[model samples]
Target chain A: MDANWIAIAASVLLQSSPLIIAVCGETLSERAGVVNLSLDGSLLLSALAGFVAAYFSSSLLLGFLAAAGVGALMALIVAFGSLALRQSQVAVGFVLTLLGDSLSAFLGQNFTRLPGPWVQRLPIPLLKDIPVLGPIFFNQDLVVYFSLVLVAVTTWWIFHTRPGLELRSAGERPEAAFARGVAVRRLRYWYAVLGGALVGIAGAAYSLDVKIGWAEGHTRGLGWIALAIVIFGGWSPLRGALGVLLFVATRSVISVVLQRSLGESSVVILNALPWLLMLGVLVVVGGRFSEQVLSRLPAALQRPFRGLLRAAPPAALGAELKEG
Target chain B: MSRPAWLPRLWPLLPSFVALLLTSLLLLAFGASPPLAFGAIWEGAFGNQDRLLTTVAFWIPLMLSSLGLLISFRAGLWNIGIEGQFILGAIGASWVALSLQLPAPLQISLQMLAAMAAGALWAGLAGVLKRWGVHEIFGGLALNNLAIILTNYLIAGPWQPPEGGSFRGTAPFHADALLPLVGATRFSVVALGLALLAFGLVVLALRNSAWGLRLKALGRNPRSALLLGVSSRRETLLAMAFCGALAGLGGAVRVLSWFDSLRQSISGGIGYLALMVVILAAFRLLWTPLVAFFFAAVLSGSVVLQLRTQLHSSLGNILTGVLVLLVLLFGNLDSLRAWWAEWRAGRRRS
Candidate 1:
């Protein structure tokens, strides 16, 4: 039983690695005040693009690069729409999502169900020798390690570094940031595109590492979950990683339980678990109930506890930044 | 020479033309002849009386969903969960159709009522969540997923037809429960009339009613609206409920007049498509129904394109997305004009 639990934990981490990447990417974008609502469609399109690129070239690296390109391009459109045209980011992202999905379906029809290359697992020697910790963290593909590193790196960048401070200010108070000589619009465009490229990498991760093939709507609905997890994580990279792990763990457990006890119909209910869990988590974290709970805590504990439980998003998220 | 007054009026059409050009380029890249695809689309959407009626059938639901979205947009509420409300509406209508036995007219009316109620209830949950500090976009998206799951559970589980389960849907309703058709076409004149009536009502309400003015004021500036005696909470709830009702009516027409059964994906992305329509219409009431009809034609025409070119049906959706994006970009011509003038002046100086 202990062995089985460890295996489950490892599997959960592996499954959630891509999501961690996506949530982190989205956290960065939203921090810069742009919401990439195109994550779902972007994921699907990039998955297809990655798979196709890898299939034709037989190069896993090329596949990931292609995915990142697709993702960045999508993000660029969102940035252009929001920054240049002064349109709603949400609306543009939503339309892009639909467009991306359709384009993927149309373009990927020929490649569906075909076998393609997958990332081989690479276990670090010394780390793999460690007991449960080794298997859970060390015995994974390159993307998983990258995701793990991303959490620490992103957290440090966002909270510790000066550039990160500028990024935050761009989202939190664009006009103020501009007044202080920060190039708010340029920063927003760069962050939105960079964040989108990370999302594309997540898509490639799914196709080349996690799910391992191109299929219609491949990685469908997960983009939305990443969006939700970003909110659940309070836009903190570390917390967002944790949120992804929690979501994947819950889904894995529910699927296991349902497979043992229920038939095919239960699959629909199982599919909804992540969404319902995310909703519950958001309510607990963001709702008034959380505020009351925080107020009741001891003064010393309250600040830290509130920080963990109620991390607010950047102030100017989703708002159009105007020229001073 | 002074610009013609009508030139400003023609600005909106520029986006459509640019989108068409871009789509033509895309088609050429795909190795399909653009003119052939365009011809097929036209022929499929409006070649005959039968085809035209089918386009009309598509128009009804699209128009209704757009109207629903317009209401929410006017109230500054982003009710993204209209897709879920639409599904619940179908479930509600299906439940009434299956469980209740009444005369044809009464049954149809009751089914529609039940559908509207179900949609309202679903949308109201999001409104309540918003009031409780949950952002409506997140809440609505979550509810959309939940509603789809619920529909799937019903169709595949407890409410599975006697023939066992099929993802296609539950069994067709009794003949009496089915909506009456119009003159040999699958189209229902009553449903079309209802849609037109709803459109008329919405236009009138938006244009003339105090409630409409209040909703607009609230959307434009909540603080000012509050200062002017508008209750934000009450208006929010009303706008959401009304929007849900319109979306529910769209779902009802889809189920009763078109498919005649419940399926997991009964909403068929109509809710999202309606959003695109609303965007393309630029929130103007007069332009919405026309845009909806144009989109409906694209949808129906895509089938013909599929048959002729063997291209994927999603081409229509791609077109819709491209068109909307272009429209959004071109919507602000003043900014573009100003930028162009500044660039020209700077180039001459340099």
Candidate 2:
């Protein structure tokens, strides 16, 4: 076990970065009383678009931008359906999932088995020289650095800002916020799109780091795992870091252990451990009274801002605006 | 203020057909005439004696599995794991017929029963999980994966055929265990017969039974059904099991009728296609045949285009995605329907 201890830990951290990015983005959305169920589809489409953009243009920044653009476009579908037409966000999101899958498969069909750009790693001078921590932390790629900062910045935004206060008020009691003149719908749209952009980067992070080559059906269920981590962390940024760490760690362990314990074909069977574990965690969370506690949670959760029915995070997240 | 529901029904079908034709036109875009490509697609699928036989063979399992999809949708459930269930069913049927070494006639009956039971139990696990507070989508997703893995484990481990790793599947069932097909149609005569019978039974059950009423009520409005004490949990669990059994039957027929053995990709995304079929059929259990046959033709057609033209066959996926999007968006749009109907009435007045 000690033979690969340092390497395993390094890979685990790397693997967890995408989850961290996705969850942090979702954390923002959930905090504002909107749940973007299309995180899975958004991550997928963006990941493909990112890979495609970089493959043709050979620009990593453009790849990242493309990912974010795709994410916002996917989120737009959720925003319009849940916000404008007032359809159930969950339903629309599910439809988006199916569409995302077919569209990706169709688009990626030609691109499958094609070569993609390799993301360059940047190491800081002084920090890269720091003992064991140097190679493990400071010598990581750019997204790795942004993911950590995003968490801190999100934490600060929620606790310290004036607009954040109104957003919180909107999430907690939209009617109250509405009476106080907080534009709940507009705020939610922004949060959803922003969150979507973050999730997009999270997807592109895959092609940039772990599996640098492009492929179809890549980033399978990572978005779903991020959603589970959001709930597992109780929708807090700091704790969500742990949940993502735990998920990625489990997946890393499963691959290593199953390869040793089971043959190749059987190993295919166990490839789904990470996703199954996420679903299990979600089921456990749902059975707990946390959903009720969900309403009583942070003042800004399931309810959109600037309307009635102020509540906590996602008792029924991604619900359509009823306009009552 | 509600317009007649049937008024806008034909619109969705028309778009789907247009999309299907345009996909074929893509073949012409590559230099094959639309009619020649269409003719080749039809002939390759059902034109001659042998191709028609194999086409029927292909249709048996797909149609059966799709019917299973309709059953679940009727209860407002999306049993997306039908592909997994279909695979497991084949595995179960193979395991029984081969491992048990039963008499000829008794072997297949037992195998079919085992397949159905495996599917029901697998789906039942998800049902029980949902009953305990898990969402159906998550539960179905998990179970789909779990079933795939578990079946892979079975096939790759103890059930690994005596032939070894060159082929990763079970040993062929006994000769008598195989079902006979119609002249050139690849479908097992008995399996297709049973499916037809099951079709009638499903229609009757949905239309006449007290249980059917309960399911319909729950699907339409679970909250109101709960108020009426319809026991949503129980009905949902039962509906999932029923759907699973239907899918399992399809799996059983695949081995006995078409492929004659199980493989890793036994169901081959048919479960997903079944989801599309259910939506396209508007969750009509009886409409399963019509939709599955139509899509099956499109699928086989794409394969023809591939052999004729070097372009990607996945163009079909893009088209299907477009059709689904239009149907979903337009189906729920009250404003769109009203505008179309108003325009139609205006034309009539003139």
Candidate 3:
């Protein structure tokens, strides 16, 4: 029984690694006041690029680099289009998402469902000997460890670092940040690119590590889920990581527990669970009801509750930035 | 001053020309001939009578959904859940067609009405969720999945054929329940008439109606619109429902004419394609149908493009996507002029 539980826990962590990376990447972008709404498209295109590159060059590093490049290029388009051309970010992102999807579909015709390279598991030296926690967290591949470190680093960078403070200010009050000589446009441009590069890596992680192999829409709707979870996590990196874990855990439980007892028919209905969870999380954390409820609590409890439930977005997010 | 009379007129078509150039470059990168692909699409879409009719068949649902989107977009709503609403419409029409014992005309009319109501109700659910502080994008997305699951359940569970359940779909509906198609084609004059009627109504409503003015105000600034005494909640629900109803009608047309029974992927991403159509049209009423027809033609032609060139059918989608992006980037004359001026200034500085 214990072994089964540990296995399930480890699988959940492994499954959620890509999402964790993607969510952190998105959190970084949203923190810098840019919303990369083209995540779904970016992810699909990058997954294809990653798989294709890895297949041809036979190197995982090249696959990840190519995917990140594609991701950064897409982010640059969104940033430039919205900031320079004065187009709506959502419009640009949405168009890019569709463009990316079709582009992948057209370009990836020959690469569909073909077996390709993947990340090999590399357990830590002494940590694998430990009991439950070791097998669950430490006995995973490089991508999994990277995701863990990414969450901690992202949380620290966004909350503790001086540059992080500037990023927050860029997202929360670009005009004020600019007044303080923060170079908001340049900061936004670079951070958006950085975030997009991380997103690209996450896409590669899926094809070269998590899900494995390339197909059209290999990561469809995941970008939207990541986008929704960014809001659900209140744009916090740590919280977003937890959200992905919780989502992946519940999905595994449903597929494993329910699918066994209910048979094949239940699988179709079960597919709706993740989306339903997304809606449920957004409604619970996103609404004014949570704040109202928090306010009604005792003084001692209110602070913790407020911190836990806070879900407001960055003030300057998606706003057009004009350079004079 | 010495330029030809048509030269100024040609400026408006600049985005299309640019998009064509970009698509040509993409084709070249793929080691495919642009002329051959374009020729394939053109021949596939309009080379023969049958192909023209097929393109028109695809156009009916696309036009309906695009028209519906114009309403919601005017009200500043994304209505991404239109996909779910479209599926609900198919479900509603399927319900009527399967269970009803009415006359042919009555059955068809009832099916359409049911489809509209189902679509409106589904869209209204998203609107209500929006009212509850859930953005329609998330709500609609979730609802779309739920709608798909619901369709799958219906087809595999309760509505399964006499032989047994399968993922293919439910059994075909009775002849009386189906739409009267034009000779040897899925194209129905009735569906065409409905779409054209919707187009006329949308144009008139957006142009002359007080409601259209209210939607414009709301879309521009919701808070200010409320301050100006516009009831945003009422307008939002009404606009979403109105859009859903049309999309549902489009769904009804799909199941009733395009196919014989309720099936998987009934809308086939038409809801999303319609969104692209509206955006490409620049949200203008006059251009909506024309752009939709263009999209429909490309998509219809893709089948032939694939068959002849051994290329994937998504080339049409890529072409449209590129066009829309270019339009978003450089379609506006002001943006183009600004970019041109900036380039010249940068060169002089260097």
Best by DockQ: 3
Deviating ranges (above 4 Å) for candidate 1 = A292-302, B338-350
Q: What is the lDDT of residue B217 in candidate 3?
A: 95
lDDT of 1 by residue, A109-216 (tens): 788889999999999999997998988889888999999999999999999999999999999999999999998988998999999999999999999999999888
Please give the DockQ score of every candidate, comma-separated: 0.66, 0.34, 0.72
User: Relative to the unseen true structure, what is the C-alpha lDDT of residue A241 in candidate 3, on a scale of 0 to 100?
Assistant: 93
Write the residue-wise lDDT of candidate 2 on B1-350 in tens digits.
77777867656776667666765565555565767666667766776777766666677777878877666777888676676778778778877877776666788888889999988887787788777566666677777777667667767777777768735666666776777667645557788788888888888878889888888999888999999999987898888888888888888888777766666767766776777777766677666788778667766666676677555666555555556555655554564645467557756976
**lDDT at residue B274 of model 2 (Cα atoms):** 72
Write the residue-wise lDDT of candidate 3 on A1-324 in tens digits.
389889999999999999999999999999999999899999999999999999999999999999999999999999888776778888889889989998988889999889999999999988987889889988999999999999999999999999999999999989988898898888998989998999999999999999999888889889999999899889999999999999999988878878568865777757878888988888778766576777788999988887787688999899977543
- For candidate 2, what is the DockQ-based docking class? acceptable
TM-score to true structure, per model: 0.96, 0.85, 0.96
Order of quality (DockQ) = 3, 1, 2
* 1 versus 2: better lDDT goes to: 1
Q: Give the TM-score of candidate 1.
A: 0.96
The parts of candidate 3 lying over 4 Å away from their true place are A289-303, B1-12, B339-350
Model 3 accuracy (lDDT, Cα): 0.90
lDDT of 1 by residue, B1-350 (tens): 47778776778688888889988887888889999999999998999888888889989988888998888999998888899888888889999998999999999999999999999998898898887677778888888889888887888776789988566788888877777887656688989889989999999888899999999999999999999999999999999999999899889989888887897689888988998999888899999999999999998998999999888888898888888988877766765675567557756976
